[model samples]
Target: MSKRLSVETSSAAASSLFQQCTPFGMSIISAGFQRSAQLLEMSSLHPEKTREQILEQADQEWIPGTVFLVDVDRSLAVQHEGQSDIVLIPQPSKDPNDPLRWSQTKKNIQFAILFYWSFMTSVATNWNGPVWGIWVEIFETSYSVLNDTSAVCWCFLGLGCLFLQPTAMTLGRRCVYLFATLIQTLGNVMGGVAKNVGVLYGVNIMTGFAGAPCDSLVQISTTDIFFQHERATRISLLTFALYSGSYLGPIAAGYIVENNRFGWRWCYWFLVIFFGALLALQVVFMEDSTFVGQRENETEVEKEIIAQVISKEEGQVYVSASSEKDQNVTVFEEKDFAAPLDIPTQRTYMQRMGLIERKYNDKRPWWKIFIRPSLTLALPAIVWGGFVYGVQVMWLSLIATTQSEFFSVAPYNFSTAAVGDTNFSSLIGCFIGMFWGGPLSDKFVAWKARRNNGVMEPEFRLWFLILPAIINSGGLLMYGLGVNAGVHWILPAGFGMGCLGFGMGSGGAIVLTYALDCYPQLQSEGMVMILFLRNMIGMGFTFAIQPWLDTDGMVTTTWLMFMLSVVFNMSCLIFIMWGKKWRKMTKNLYLKFSDPHFFL
Candidate 1:
């Protein structure tokens, strides 16, 4: 009778262990217990392990809630509780109190720093302005060589644009930030010491490449941090930095170059120092904010408390949703493999080919970024915005070189430094534009959106484009005729600055804001595209301007600019009037190829 009791007691202990291990049904408990026991038997039979060790390994591998286990000899028990049935996982909240969600005052501090950084970069880019005349005298070359060099400068920016996204993907945003600024600062330092045009060009390439990511990263950073409502205001403030730098370059460069002791190289020395300060500040204050995927390593106590806080049904729903997302989609997979559906990926053919051995969304068909209807409307706007931006930026440097010299000789007899002061007018125009255009745009956009029953169409932003159009054309006309007809130079200078300020202010704000509003998710990719076009055109036109003036004279070149300005500005209005209908007709065209979620 005592022997029979011992057998029954052993059977009862085994049954209890089986029930504890299985999460679902009674049959599952029996099956799981049998499997665990058989695994232990197999482990004991192996040459490496004793029976005791086998039983320990089996216990660890067959932990509750574990679906599968491998490397049995090395397996460790995971402390999981509750049934293996679905349960909710907690997610991180988007904290409104984070720096991204800071008040207007705090946010402006960041914007101001960024604006200053942009200003310094622009100054570095355009510092060649006052000295171009010196180059002409030294090289004894036609404007073609100068033009070609300018073309090279802009082309370098395009090359930078092409690679920035790819680099950002691999190296991450902070690494790019640190390296670009460092290289740019070094480039400026080199420029101060450069002896030849070739050296200067090489330095410009470095600075431009370093600065290329600035426009892309600043806008992206803003998007990452700010909500949709605040982006326009922040963008307007930053745009001022971009346009002001061009006008401000000559102010500092002219003053420095005018001093017999300092000379043109002094301008670059200033940039080196300026960027050095910014780099230091960024390193000290900037923190990484990439949202990390939630960890499932919560302790038993934390899990219990959270479970009590959230209902079981809600928890289950959250887990189900979380499991469906590719929160940690590996870079290799994105570049190489196809999704399970056999759908092709959206990367360029070269990108796919480069990672042929790896896999993710690789097999998807290639899709053009600009072909979507929303982006199609956006493309022209981007081109026009870039044209306006490039034209003004180049104009200041060009005038300081070609026109300033003309004004400084014989009858005019203004000093080179005096010629540099002409940029002050443009700078003043930029300030006025920033002041006038920024707030008015915000007001107009909000009001228009409200008037349209809060539907929030992108076209509402274009209404602000018209005034800047007239101002830009009018300013070009004034500046042109003032030079050609030789009116009291101030008349044309003031008009030129006013019109430029007007155009730059309105043009920069609206184009950027419109782009952001239209494609909130793809803001970074779209911004890079905008910079690509704008810089390309700006570079092309800078070289083209002097030749055009030399070949056709100031009057013809100015008039041509005026015509282009009017035609493009008018095209913006046409799109604004009909763009909503077009967007409705072709929704998610980009979705057929690229995952819109990646951008979001």
Candidate 2:
């Protein structure tokens, strides 16, 4: 009977172990356990294993930006890198405070505030376009001299992005948002009372410096609060903010200047008032979205081994086992280890409103982070993406600078308000572009992914660019040729301008989505290079538009712009075919940047 009881006990132990490992899709966890076992067996739980080392091992085979977006077969339940049943990219951590896990209402509220700032600040910045002719008369300056003010602003806009983003990364995003608002408000106040072109120059400088975050921080915040699939739409909204404000600001400024009561100076005063209101809203609602996760001190293997030991023995525990020594020993832990992770207490409302979140303690030096953006230019794909959007910005600058100069004294002889009204068509086109660039692109890519066994490539974004490229390049030809022929204002302003607006809105979305999807490591830095190249090209064209118009005549210049736009915009075809090969070539560099601690 005793012998029979021994046999039954052994059988029971074997069944319990088998049952423990039988949960559905538990094989994924077991694979990780195998890695954890190998980790221990290699060095008997080396205490000095750094977070970077662990991450490098975990990230062995995966390429940057190549992700399994959808599960084609029902049998597939978990992604190797992420635990989500639905395969959400940038998988949400269990921490309740992670922005990814925030409630939809909370996420929407925060994003709405960011979108508002992007729109209104752009409005304040570009109000000068409609008033350029009026400024020429009042300040006794040439149109080129007036355009120089914008040229200065564009230069500073790039510089501001480089300098301010590091601070935003280090101090917290909200601090920079508040600081920029204060500076812009000051600039607008000066613009209202300015007596000369020099004062206007100063106004542009300050405002441009303040507006840098519009490109860099706004994109970072978008990525922080949204998932991979969701980001294209939200980023497109940011592009819309830029287009609408560029077009609408001049419209608002035109009417304000045309009013008998307000006059041209009131454009700045109106911005000052609006900016004051924006500052208040931002303070109340634009919560800092920065979150850098901390690595656990203990490994999964450590947790499993320790849980079998006494809870009292865990004051400071170290497990040292070696095949050479033929013994396993668990001793005092040198570092305190918390029990398995549970959702930490959620922050109170006041805590969330604090200027900086307590958890954002990235130990990398601020200067290193500042220089990182510059290093990204070495990536060939990044450089190519910059040229694509840089050309689009070149067109935008042309529209803003040329419209007042062209129509203000043409056969059409448009008044200031009428010049502003041209932008209404641009605005309408932007609305359509937003829908095409954002939701439609997302759904289409998703459908394509389903067809491709549920694997989505970053290059998938470039496929839709074909439509935008043709429309945009054609729009340039129409606007230029129409102006050269001095046709009715309706054709160039309505159809041509509308087509340009569509390109700006849709093109911005596609290029931005593609670049970030290709290299999401430190997204702010990745975007900085693109915008830097964009602003530099924009600044160059801002200075060149008039000279070119004078030197080559309207017809020749128009043809030249059409061709330049065609070459840059249509290059998406080349990328569409070979982008995956390029990505594979850069995979090592991408992996280096993706590591949070790689620089350190």
Candidate 3:
């Protein structure tokens, strides 16, 4: 097709051409439709005299995540990124308002908001770690008591998604993100003035409730603005933001606690200040990424037909009228064709900044969306993802719960500032790990896809995960064992913490990317289920940590954690081996969940 849809054609001729075009589903989730095997059988112009005519000819068929990425034949019509053969997945539509067609400057601004939000959410939750000792003294409570409050907070964090995500789906990402920030701001005010454990409990619970989006909503927002190919790198950067805040928060908290003038309470105040500023930036600049396109009124079959005809017209794929006699033929004769002219228009700035850009024909009630996570939990892939990510959280929670107790009393006799400074090691490790897992992994998968004749399997990325599994196990041993052995502070504080942070950074990012890839249509619900289970698991581990350490001591507990990390992380092998098989088995279930519109 001609690059410009402005080239008009006769209505009757366009109708006849569309009728002959094969059926393919439009995701309604993207500007460019995501092509897959789910395409329906359709009538063709070619006749079936002795045998059926196959208009489409290919050396190999494509699958989900698989596309003519290299465009080796270079016959595909859509615009390629730069001069590269890489075809944009979920091809961008002509609509200038489409999120997929957004300018780089616009995308960066959107991404910055999400990245900062995730970063601050993590920081707010973890900054309290360094101050736990001081709080314990001031509140006349034990470390175990404070840890229990945190366990409850984890529960709130997980459960918070049940309410917030559906509202995001019903309302729009803009409002939910802003509300989350507001809640966090108020919770910090509560925390800054907590005079007793009861008040801190409220603070912890409120923070947990507000912080839920860190695990799920930010992910949904990321996917809204990025394509499948660009997702890994972007998610990795956001993952880095999450961990940077997590590890860095304690460092800041430690310094604050050590300084009498500013004090630990300033930690809460600082969050109030920065996140308040973030909320303001968002109020002014955050535009809703949701794009309601032309297919809103079309039936499934019609939508698919409209979508595929458009794809064929765009030249992403082609059909050849070949039978057994000419089966060896591989030729694609491109012809100029026009795309549908009716497209969504760009919204006014006021409309763009509106708190709710409700989906067109998005009639599902909030309760229907609320219950989606339960159904999603049945998926084996999401369950496994939860366990992997949850284990990573368990390690972080363990550090928060034990950092002061372990470092403050002992041969090392570290002060609050020293304990805080230890976070620098994890921060360094997270940066490196995110590089390896995020960007390197993205390159690795694309390479694999090219080698597989431009076919990409979500599982291609899982192979890289094996390294993280091994790294995570080693880190657990180093941290727990080194701490118990009372080796040099560097042994446990630096190497152990560094490795743990590396695993946390790398493993969490890869697993999240894999899950979303497997079920792009269900990103929100899948994430809701995954984060819920992950936090619950983190909560259970948190509740158990004090007792487990008390009963088993650091040595046995270290071994236990070591085994847990190795086993859960290596579970990726199961998915790596049978993940595709499992996906195939659950295909019907997946379709039912994705419904008329996929998340893309």
lDDT of each: 0.58, 0.77, 0.76
TM-scores, all candidates, are 0.67, 0.82, 0.83
True-structure lDDT of candidate 3: 0.76
lDDT of model 1, residue 243: 64
Residues 1-600 of candidate 2: C-alpha lDDT, one tens digit per residue: 999999999999967776787575478667888998897886675444443434344345345566666645422322222332234556454455667666677788899888989998788777677788888888999989977888889888888998888888787888899999999999999988999999988998999989989977898888887877888899899999988999999998889888999898888888888899999998888788877654221122222222212221333332322112211111112122122356465666788778765576455788887888877876767888888988988888898898898888868788998889889988888888898889999888888778876667888888888888888887887788898788877778889989999998999888889888887664677888888888889899999988989899988998899888888988998889888778778877866776656667
lDDT of 1 by residue, 478-591 (tens): 877777787887866667766766677667777776765554434555676777777777777766776687799878877887787778656677767766555444334423
Candidate 3 residue-wise lDDT, 1-600, digit = tens: 663443455656666765665554223322233332223222233323221111122211222222444444444444456556565554444555566666667788899988888999999888777777788888999988999999989999999988888888778878888888999999999988878999988988888998998888888888876767788888888889988998899998888878879987889999999989999999999887765342221122222322333345444442322111121111111111122457455556887788777653144677888887877776788888988899999999988888888888878778898888888888988898898888899899888877876556888888888888888789888888998888898878898889888888888889999998887667888999989989999999999999999999889989988988888988888887888888767766776777734322
Candidate 3 clashes: the total is 4
> How far in Å is the alpha carbon of 259 misplaced in model 1?
1.8
**What residue runs in model 2 are displaced by over 4 Å at the alpha carbon?**
1-61, 74-86, 294-342, 597-600
User: Distance from true position, residue 30, model 3, in Å?
Assistant: 58
Residue 106's lDDT within candidate 2 is 77
Which of 1 and 3 is the better model by lDDT?
3
lDDT of 2: 0.77
Could you tell which candidate, 2 or 3, scores higher by TM-score? 3
Q: What shift in Å separates residue 592 of candidate 3 from its native position after superposition?
A: 2.0
Q: Which stretches of candidate 1 lie over 4 Å from their true place?
A: 1-99, 102-106, 138-143, 289-403, 593-600
Worst 10 residues of 3 by lDDT: 323-332
